[model samples]
Target: MSKKISYEFLEGIQLPITVKKDILEINKESERLLFINKIFQIF
Candidate 1:
C-alpha cells in the first residue's frame, strides 16, 4: 500500500526532494486518518 508508493517515489530520481517530502507527508496524514476512522468504528 503506502509502503509501495513511498518506495516508488524514493526510486524516482527525477522528482525534486521537496515534492517527495510533500508526498510522503500526505501519505502519512491519510494513513493517520484511516487509523482514526477504524478506531472510531470499533467504538
Candidate 2:
C-alpha cells in the first residue's frame, strides 16, 4: 500500500547515506504519530 510507494520513492531519490537514514527516522516518527492520532480518533 502506501508503505511500498514511500519505500520506492525513497529509493528513487539519490541522497547520501546519512541523510537517507535521517529522513527514514523522521518518517518513522511521523508514522507513529499518525497511528496515535488514529487511535485517539477511534476512542
Candidate 3:
C-alpha cells in the first residue's frame, strides 16, 4: 500500500525537481505519523 503511494507520487518523472523533493518530504512525514500511531496502539 505504501509502495503504491510512493510509486504514484513518483510516476511523473518530468515534474520539477523541487516538486519531487516535496513529494518525498510529504511521504516521510506521513510515514512518521503512521509509525507514531502504531506505537500508540501497541500500549
Please name the candidate that would achieve the greatest TM-score relative to the true structure. 2
TM-score of candidate 2 against the unseen true structure? 0.44
What does the lDDT come to for candidate 2? 0.55
- Candidate 3 pairs with clashing backbones: none
In model 2, the runs with Cα more than 4 Å from the true position are: 1-3, 27-43
Q: What is the per-residue lDDT of model 3 for residues 1-43, given as tens digits with 9 covering 90 to 100?
A: 3545554645744656775565556556567446434545987
TM-score of each: 0.39, 0.44, 0.37
At residue 20, candidate 2 shows an lDDT of 52
Give candidate 3's error at residue 18 in angstroms. 30
lDDT comparing candidate 1 with the true structure = 0.55
Model 1 per-residue lDDT tens digits across residues 1-43: 4556455645754557775565556557557445434545986
Q: What is the lDDT of residue 9 in candidate 1?
A: 40
lDDT at 28, model 1:
70
Q: What is the lDDT of residue 32 in candidate 1?
A: 43
- In model 1, which residue pairs have backbone atoms overlapping below 3 Å? none
What TM-score does candidate 1 get on C-alpha atoms?
A: 0.39
Cα error, candidate 3, residue 26 (Å): 11
